[model samples]
Target: MTVTAPEMANGIFGGVFNLNYSGDKNRLIWHRHWLVCISCGAYAGVGCFLFAPRGLMYGFVASLFTSCCSIWADYVHIEDPQHLAHLVDRWAAFHFFFVLVCECAYVLHMPIWYLTMTLCLALALFSLSRSSRSRQSWVLLHSAWHVLPMGLLLLPGLIS
Candidate 1:
C-alpha cells in the first residue's frame, strides 16, 4: 500500500506535473530548506560521532535529512505541473532508500540518543515549515521548534 506519485498528486488536488504559480514558489522555498536541513544534519552527525560517540543521534540526524529531501522532492513534483507525478515517484523512491540507510545506521550504533532527539526536533521544524501558510508563521514555528528542544536538552545539564 505504498502511495504512488499519481495517487499523491490526485489526493492533493493537483495535476501530475502542473503546479500553479504559488506551488512553484513554495517548492522553491522547500528546496532551500532541504539544502539547509541536509547540511545541518551532516554537521550534527559528524559532531555526534566526534564528540558524543552516539549512534542514535547520528541516525536521527540522518533521518531528518532524508525526510527533508523527500519533502523537497514532493514539492518539486507539485510545482512542476507538466510532470508532477514523476517527481513524486522519484521522491518516494529516494525516501525509501534513505530511510533504509538511517535504519541500518541506527542498528549499527553509529548515532547516539542526543542525536536522535535532535533529529526528531528537526523533523518537527520541517513539518511546521511545510504546514504554515504564512512566511512569518513558518519562521516563528521553526525558531520555536529549534529552540525548545535545545533548551530542554541543556536544562538537565544546567540544573546539575
Candidate 2:
C-alpha cells in the first residue's frame, strides 16, 4: 500500500517537510540545504546521462525526469503544506526505484565502494528520529542521501 502525507508522519516521525522549525536562522539553513540537494540532484541527473552506459542510461533518464517532477513538487509544497505528504510519498517511491537501478548498474563495476556508499546512505536514512529535534541533521543527512549515489558515477570502472 502507498503511504500518504499524514501516514508519512507516522513512518518518518515528522521528518522531511516539518515546518515547525526553531527560528528563521535554522529555517534559513534548512532552505540552503534544500537548494544544495536540488543542485546536486540536477547535477547527478545530467552526469548520469553523460557518464552512464547506453543500456543503463534509460534508467537514469527516467530517474532524472521523475526527479525534475520531484523538484517542482518540493518547491510547490513548501509554499503550501497541504500537498506535502502526497508529494513526499510520490518522490519517496521514485527514490527507492532510483536506488535499485543505481545498485544494479554500479554494483556490476565497483562492489566495495558501492557497499560503502550504501552503508552511508542507510545510516543517513535510518537515523532520522525527528526533524523537529534535529533539523540540521535531518536536512544534512537527507542531502547526503541525494549526494552519495552520484559518487557511483566516479567509480573507476563505472565511469564511461
Candidate 3:
C-alpha cells in the first residue's frame, strides 16, 4: 500500500500508526507509549536468533535496539530530537554496520547488488521520514520501521 494513501492518510501506513505529541513535555518523559514497530522487531529478531542462528542474529538484535532507542527517544522526549538528531544518525549508521557484519559472517560474502539495494532503501526511507510532515507520516515511518530489521532477520536463511 502507498504509505501516503489518502484513505489511511493520518499515520505512517495510514491512520493506524498515527502519533500525537504530548502537550506537556513532562507528560512524555516516563510514560512512553509502546509503539509497534521496534517492539515487534525486537521480539522477532530475538526469536530468529534463538530458533535459527544461521544468520547475523546479533547484528539484527542490536539494529533493533538502536531503532528502539532512537524512536523512544524521539517520541518520549525528555530531550529534543532536533538537537540530538546526530545520535539517531549514529544509531542508523550502527544499524547498517551490524547488518553488514551479519552478511559477512554468515553469508561468506555479500554481493554488490545486495549492498547497493540496502543503501538505496535506507536513503529512500530516510528521505521519506524527513520530508514527511504529518503526524500520520511520522506514525507511518515509525510503524514501517520494521521493514529493514525483518529483512535483516530473513536475509540469511534466504541466501544460505
Candidate 4:
C-alpha cells in the first residue's frame, strides 16, 4: 500500500501530521496561527524586561503553558470546527486565570502583571486573526481589537 504524496499529506497520520507537527508546510492555517501566538508570547516576555524582571519570567512561563496547550491540542487532532471552538474557549479561560495571577503579582509591584497583559493582548490578536478568513479588512479589524488592551493597561498607569 504505497500512499501518494497528496494522500499521505492529507491523511491523519502522515504528511498532514508532519506539516502540522514540524510546521514545515502550511497545509493548515492553524499551524501558522499557533506559530504566531508562540512568537507573540515570546516577544511579550522579552518586552516585559523594560518593566520588571519578574514580569519577564512570568511572561515566559505563561507563554510556555500556552505553547504546551496548543501542542497538546494539535496532537489530539482537535481541528474540527466544533472541537476547535471548544479548545479555543478552554484556552482563553485558562489564560484569563493566569492573567489574574499575573495581575496580583503586578499590583504588588512584582512586574509580572505587565508581561501577562502583553501576552493576553497578543493571544487575543492571534485568536481573532485565526478565527476567520484571511481577508484584509477582517485582519485589520481583528488586529485593531487585539491592541485595545493597551488602553486598559495605560489607564491604570495614568491613574497611579
| lDDT top scorer | 2
Better of 2 and 3 by TM-score: 2
State the lDDT of candidate 2 residue by residue for 50-121, as single tens digits: 336545555555556655655554443433434554355355545645555465557444465665766556
lDDT of 3 at 141: 57
TM-score of 1: 0.33
Prediction 4 TM-score vs. true: 0.35
Model 4 over residues 102-135: C-alpha lDDT tens digits? 5546544536666577556755564454444544
- Output the worst ten-in-a-row residue range by lDDT, candidate 2: 20-29
Worst 10 residues of 1 by lDDT: 13-22
User: lDDT for each of the candidates?
Assistant: 0.44, 0.48, 0.48, 0.43
Better of 1 and 3 by TM-score: 3
Per-residue error (Å), model 2, residue 121: 1.9
Best by TM-score: 2
The digit string of per-residue lDDT tens for model 1 on 2-27 reads 98766665444223222222344344
**2 versus 4: better TM-score goes to:** 2
Error of 4 at 130 (Å): 5.6
lDDT computed for candidate 2: 0.48
User: If candidate 4 were superposed on the true structure by all CA atoms, what would the RMSD be?
Assistant: 12.4
